[model samples]
Target chain A: MGDHLARAEDFENKAEKKLSGWGLFGSKFEDAADLFDKSANSYKLAKSWDKAGSTYIKLANCNLKLESKHEAAQAYVDAAHCYKKTNINESVSCLDNAVNIFCEIGRLSMAARYLKEIAELYESEQNIEQAVVYYEKSADFYENEEVNTSANQCKQKVAQFSAQLEQYQRSIEIYEDIARQSLSNNLLKYGVKGHLLNAGICQLCKDDVIAITNALERYQDLDPTFSGTREYRLLADIAAAIDEEDVGKFTEVIKEFDSMTPLDSWKTTLLLRVKEKLKAKELEEDDLT
Target chain B: MAASDPNKLMAKADKQTRLSLTRWSADWKSATVLYEQAANGFRVAKDYENAKIAYEKASKGQEMLSSPWDAAKHMESAAALAKDLRHWQEVVDFYRRASELYMECGRPQPASDALAKGARALEDSMSEEAIQLYTDACTILEDDGREQMAFDLYRAATNVYIKLEKYTDAASFMLRLGLAADKCNATNSQCKAYLNAIVIYLYAHDFIQAEKCYNDCSQIDAFLRSDQNRCASKLLAAYRDGDVEEIKRIAQSSVISHLDHVIVKLARKLPTGDVSALKAEDEEEALDENDLT
Candidate 1:
């Protein structure tokens, strides 16, 4: 590590000197970039991420001086990966710098791709706020690039985390919009039923009796075929139970739905929220008695 | 020429619609008027689908003519037809179109009103849409310097969270309401918001946040002098002692319950049946889980 650092300093000092044609004022970034790249590789061999990362950053600067935008962005991305091993915030900053360069060069697709990497990194770190921001950016870029599948995939992540953050309306809107687009294209139209069901669950929590019933009719309109699906019926039954203020009926309806297709924990948690309203109503009734 | 002849009326309306559209390519005002007449003709003939289509056509023509108010009206008519047919998504879309038209006219109040109608219709079944409509309306109003309306809408949003049993979030929103109220010199509203925040935080079993809420509320003149606030102090003492009945007494006291119905309901669910030692039991359970893990 010490030998690599000494050699890296020697390269950097030489790289910083002024160039004057012929021998380039006794300096040449082409050699300097090469030397920095070597130092970075040696640091990687020694498993010193900190050293490798900084050296790669220097190499990236060298690549920038050579007017190789793509190479410069790639080196920055490499540096980000090395920084990610021990210091996540540093990794994020490095990746942001790379993305900025890519964005500046009109390489939207590449920028979007790296943005998704950053989002995934944030997700792994449980920095949900940052993850949502990057995912949203990636989704937008992918959508602009006509990469529909990747855009929707990123949108799903945004929706899921938004729900986790208790921003239910934001999550529901994303699902509903994507589902409507799918229905119109007759592409995976059958999937709209689940999306409507998720929207219903979000609605059920909102304490708006008006919105829940009205949503049922709207779902039928959004995806006419959804009206006949098991999930649709399940949502209807739950809404009915809410109207009746029947906890037993609500539980039974949920059980019946699970029988059709077992409820995952996420779905169960959502149902529990609906059941909470029922609990309060039942208690109020008990108090009256 | 019989007024009650449905088939003839439909035929005449359709012909006029085709002629007006084909012949009046350069005159949008006339086209809009003709389309509206056609829409009414179709409505009289009980041809709802065609009526909606004609109304939509009229809306488009009016929009092109830069008559946004007229465009919004036609779109609203189309929305009514769609609503009658139970085409709820179309209803929402038409309302959104109307709102957008109003926005194009630089009429924020009418735009907000249009969204509120959509919010009302969707609030029962699609709360997310309802919330979005309300949020968008509030954003427009807020940007237009209608801070009172914005604060009220935010409070409404928090009320929805409370109904959903999301106490921590409800409290956070209430805090926002309190801050906004303070800025506007709505002293009573400010204290109510802060007290509401404290109750919600207490319900959430987050003592630190509840204390912070209490401190904030205590500074408010309305809270300092009110009977409810006095009861709230007693309620806090009950909570510390884990006295379920004492907590209930203070909560159910006449003055406190009227301040917020949702809080009492939330408090009912707060009791764990073993109120002897609050923090110790939870900590021990945590340790037990950690050991298992």
Candidate 2:
């Protein structure tokens, strides 16, 4: 009985080989279909899932030869699932193939579901970056599916990660430089002011003017509206520090400030400072007389 | 008075008058002979002014006597004397006179000879200042339908243009030279003009036009059996547009046999990739093959 079973298995293998060759070469639709079905059944009964999947793939190819696209796609999906049970790598590859096939067949949502499944798998692996990258790819694919809020959320995640990455990289350099300078100078008023100014610029890069002002006040007082002419105000601040009591010098600073057209609030505050210093100097001279 | 005695006195007076006439004829003949001697002496002494005057008087006297040979000879002598004295203007005048006399005397060869001499003298001593004279001579020759001689003057003018690098003018004259040579059945000179045109176009680097000229030269050389390598070289140089390898192939394969020195210089200046190692590898392979052998 065992010899008879072995003979039966040899006969099935020979029949499968003949069927595969016939499926490749036979031009008639009925013959090709019959051969492919025989090969697929033989592979399935032999417990060779990989070979079974390939036979199903060949069956799908035969369907494509017959221009039976719907049957071909079903056969490909079945083959993909068969490969999935054996290897996750093959499963992802087959899933990608099915997604492409679904996209080609204009079943974009089905294609997107396959992409989401892949992204979720990556996400479960804690490979959020790769998941985000694939999610962005799926969003591009579903850009026409406007009602798909999932794709929109994916796009938003991409933007949020991109901005966060840029901000993180920029903060590293900016904070390190500020910390080093502050330590070495012992945070003197002028040194603290320099650090604050640098920190303000960094905050501005981050679009956080509140943080910029808080940083600035650690060294010196910061005027509101320090957006456009902050550099000019800093120059005036330096001039005031150097010669605090000279009304003529303060008047010159005010004149220099006035010469700039379209002044921002920073320049306005600097002008006011110059005026107050000049007034204080005049009052002191009057007292001396 | 007796009749015989009066007749005798009249005869005697007639005899005396005849003797005086004879003496005067002799004196006139002697003076004519002396003028001939003086003209020949002045000509031999290189005194063209005196020779011209003496020859003029001798010619007149011979004309009065209806001595055509004497008149022709004296006029020819005067022309020769003027030519020998390098008096070109007077030489042309004397030559014209001599030619007219020779033609009148029915010596057409001598007239033709005298005219040719005058034309040659003008050509030899011709200067830029004498352009009008040259033009006049050319006009006369052309009006007489002597285009071959006119082409000589044209060629001379072309030489002036060549001196000035007026290639277009030189080419124009060269074309005229070809036409004149064709008219005169002078194939050799026509071929020379065609060759000259090819050279001009080659110098101008006008290859397309030069190719046409080269074809003409080739056709001429076919019958003349002359080597056209020089012209072919020029054509190659004008038509060549690439590096030395292409030029070398063309020069080697075409009728042109010589390599251009400029091409050689340029090839030397071109950066050659170092291939000695590659060649060494080939040599090693050859050595290995020999060892196996």
Candidate 3:
């Protein structure tokens, strides 16, 4: 690591000297860019991510000076990758720079990919709101390029995070729409049951039994085969359980489903919340009686 | 075991095992064991065709024994053998069957994964069907509240559509994506989708549709305040006014520049004619002529 660092510093010194003593009509920036590139690689080898990132930035500046927009953008992307281990915010900023340059150069797909990387970084940092923002941007870029599948994936993340934020309505709507779109495609037909189930669950979370019932019915209409699935039965039974104000039945239904197919924590949490609401209602009714 | 040649005997034995399962009194365990042994023998002989058949028989026996997961695994093996033989259709069918078996056992994640794998296997040879599989896989995961896992499936499907130049379908999907994003309260994504749709419309020279998209987006409070909305509205106004320079100016603006590459390219191609206003003028002229008549 020390040996690499020494090499990096030496290269940096040479780049500075070359830049400072620029001869007329010489490709000074190009030569400096090459030196800086080597310096950045050495820094990376030394595991000095911050230094590598900064060196790449310098390289990008040189590339920009030489009117190499694509290389400048690429350098920025490389810089972002290096910064990712050391400073997430810096990495994100570097990526943002790369995305802008990519877009400027009409590399929409590349820009979109970088936008996704930015979203992922924010996601890892637990900055959900920011993550959604970038995911949305990337999804849009992907969509504009006729990359529906990629866009859908990003949209799914946005939906998932929003659901976590208790934006149940929005989450439900997105799932329902994607589900509906999937139905027309033969390969996607099998997934309709799962989508409707998620939408049904989101509906249940609103704590309106009638609305949940209506949504379930709407889902049935939307996907004719959904009524035959285990997911449908589970949602229907839960809705019945909630409507009857039977906390026991609700628990029983969840337990029955859990036995057959384990529910993830997200579902478990949402189901528990529904169960709590049911319990609250049951107690209120008993008091009135 | 080698009375008639082991490979031929194994192939014949798997067929007989499949045929013998007609009666309820037949023992599925013995049949499954025999099929597995035959499949292994065939695989050892490098006879993938017979191995695939034997695995299918084994999968059927497992299904009869009420072990859908094991059945799915056997079916997956059959699918893999079929893939090795380059039987694309059989690979898809086996994967679908395996996925169904997994779904029957209430393991949606694996079920979805199986379909995705099938899609991947078919991607090079049969892109259209691969997209179908991908879409199915994504839908399953999304429905199961595992949308996070289905992300790549969506991306793969989109890439296929773009490769096929199904721009209209892709654009419609983008609109749907926007709506989904809107539901998630992802303001930026929603704005981008709306703007993207408009750009696609403009790219297609559907100026009237672009205007309609702009008007629709302007209704949303978040979009109304978004930079994307600002960029879209400016471009639309420039189109209406037939201000070529203004269109050029907006298209080159930092805001538009930061948009997706496709949108940027489309924006650069926006017609300088009075597309929206000309239609309005023609409509007005028609009304005036009708009144005179």
Model 3, A167-223: lDDT tens digits are 899889888988966764536766778778777888998998889888988886675
What digit string (tens of lDDT, one per residue) describes model 2 on residues A222-245? 221122244436444434433455
- Could you give me the TM-score of model 3 versus the true structure? 0.50
| Deviation of model 1 at B185, angstroms | 75
Q: Cα RMSDs of all predictions? A: 29.1, 51.0, 30.8
- Residues B72-123 of candidate 1 have per-residue lDDT tens digits of 9788778867766767788789989999999898988878767766765675
Task: Using DockQ as the measure, name the better of candidate 2 and candidate 3.
Answer: 3
Question: Which residue pairs in candidate 2 collide?
Answer: none
Top-scoring candidate (TM-score): 3
CAPRI quality of model 2: incorrect
RMSD of model 1, in Å?
Answer: 29.1
